[model samples]
Target: MILRMAWRNIWRNKLRSITIMMAVALGLTAGVFASAMINGMMQSRFHEFIENQISHLQLHHPDFVGQQEVYQHTGVPRDQLDRVLENPMVRAATVRTKVHSMIASATYTGGVELMGVLPENEKQTTGFHNNVVEGNYLEKHGTNEILLGSALAEKMRVQVGSRVVLTFQDVDHNMVSAAFLVTGLYETGYTRYDESFALVHMDYLNNQINIGNSFHEMALLLTDIDHIPAMTKELEVMFPGLHVRAWNEVSPEMSVLVEAGDVFAYIFLVIILLGLAFGLLNTMLMAVYERTREIGMMMAIGMNKQRIFALILFETLALSLVGGVFGIVGSWAIVSWVSRVGIDLSAFDDVMKEIGFSPVIYPVLETAFFITLILFVMLTALIASIYPSLRAMRLNPAESAKR
Candidate 1:
């Protein structure tokens, strides 16, 4: 059969065939590794964003999202918070008052998103306690204790026990400034969060502003993010007056990221595949040129041009198939091992943290990538074989024997 002939011809020059296989394998391995690394980094950023900033869902005053003014409190009574918590999918929830305000230390004044939180509840809602780099989380019944992010602290040159003035407009648009003692310095590893956000006790903002029985925002944690859609609808129906939204709705940039990541992976795959395709074309072309005399002999003995073309394509496909297997399986083994150990990126921590990324990355490649890459390699093989196969088909039995 033509298939068996093509298989046998490959072994006639085993060294050359093996060399091409190695080249394909190595090229694809590098591609897969790079793709996995990028995916891992993106995954880490999203995980951190969800864990530290956007809890799973949020409930806010309908007008709060529009203007975010001081007076746009969640109109829902405080006691109804229990009704939202009663859902089985709800893990934890916390209410907060937010104001874009300025925190002034002795000689520094910096803008910050001042958050009034119930410390213990917030721990369950957003992992705030674990992010604390210095000092403990807020006390249960604290008056004016504040938590400062490391970047904010550095910008203000303020440390623990430093008294800072927080000046913002109250609900009535009256300018009110309150003094808060910095009880803790927290570092969320996200420089933007650190540079612009600080935490304080909710009671201070509520009583100080005289917004009794009301909160501006409520953040929720779910048993799993998959439950967000269902929970959002449930809560929206329950608190019809409040604007309930999932994390993605709250952060459209992250929503776009989650959707567009696959496009990025495919682009990387195409670039690498093109590189491999050139190498494959060169290798296959050499195989055809070296086998010109043999190809002529076969044609003289009655093998047709179509059979010769088929033979060359089959050989190229076999070469690519073997290499594709090695590349996919081997890359997966490498990525799995590294995922456990993690690739230390401490050298680039400062730059990475500025982008809200973690220093260490654990490479991860989905099983789908292997299938896609294997098919892509097959397509590359098909394209690479065309020119060389045509060259073999054009060979003259009498003329090819001379050289």
Candidate 2:
């Protein structure tokens, strides 16, 4: 009976009721959609770094991790790699000889982190070959072949088949210079990364540095990301001498940024809801003021104050819930359609790439987020109903009945 009365009371002023409902719906839709877009951008950037660049876990010599010394190889035998590969959770693994070196073309020179990797293993682990936008990936038997990032190529004014000079200290700390053919130019849409890294054939680099088949880094991609913590511990136990680190440990800033994005999304939604709460408060207060005479008549007819407060509370909740349902359904439909098609910010392509974000964004929201949103709406309605319900209960029956 109370619910039916509450539902019917809101429609007594149809214009005001519909106006508040539409306001709530529009505010929630905008807030949820904005949150979804931010989520999508953060997820895209994080996965791009993890899957295509960093992998899930890495193994390195203690000195190599600390100082990046070329001679600080993992010192583990090749059989150790075979053992790691035998693990069921390790989906793919590759070893690389990493060095900080200067790469120079005829026109320009720049610093690069040169990674010498087995082409097939590297491809399986990082799928870097898929990013080759121009020319071919390193050939299986290719010697002295190098793949330069597209940004690096542009900065160096080099192209496919261009001869470039690589200069670095060999394992002995002796400066060594060699010529490498640029077999490919790849772009991962992370401009800073593209400008800072290059790849070469492992055997060729090993012979050049006089480090026979030794590698400084071992990167691994796991079958499931949820296994990262367990796998990191397992690898540590297996290779007690080598330093094993998860992707988050390697890049703490990215992890922090992803977490901050989630917090910011909720904060933003709360700010919007607060605004809606004020709107709800104003509307309910006015409704209470206008219906004073009606409420007084009920009170005179023996309706108790507690029931009167509950009626007002129920009316506020009903108004909010009806609006919330419409808003959630509308936001879901918009998010679903937008996620499928994606929102292109091609106009900001260069800036987006420079900052390690994709130009295209696909909005997404978890089911749990919608559930929480409903709870938030209910809470807001309850808080907004408080003052108005108190005012309704405080009215004098004789005076209100006369008015």
Measured by lDDT, the strongest candidate is 2
- Write model 2 residue lDDT over 151-185, tens digit each, in one string: 99998999998999999988899999999999899
Per-residue alpha-carbon lDDT of candidate 1 for residues 30-104, written as tens digits (9 for 90 to 100)? 888888888898888888888778888999988888788889998667778788789899998888888888889
Tell me the alpha-carbon RMSD of every candidate: 2.0, 1.2
Query: What TM-score, to 2 decimals, does candidate 1 have?
Result: 0.94
Candidate 2 residue-wise lDDT at 192 = 92
lDDT of each: 0.86, 0.91
* Residue range with the least summed lDDT across 10 consecutive positions in model 2: 74-83
List where candidate 2 sits over 4 angstroms from the true fold.
none
* Candidate 1 global lDDT: 0.86
* Weakest ten-residue segment in model 1 by summed lDDT: 258-267
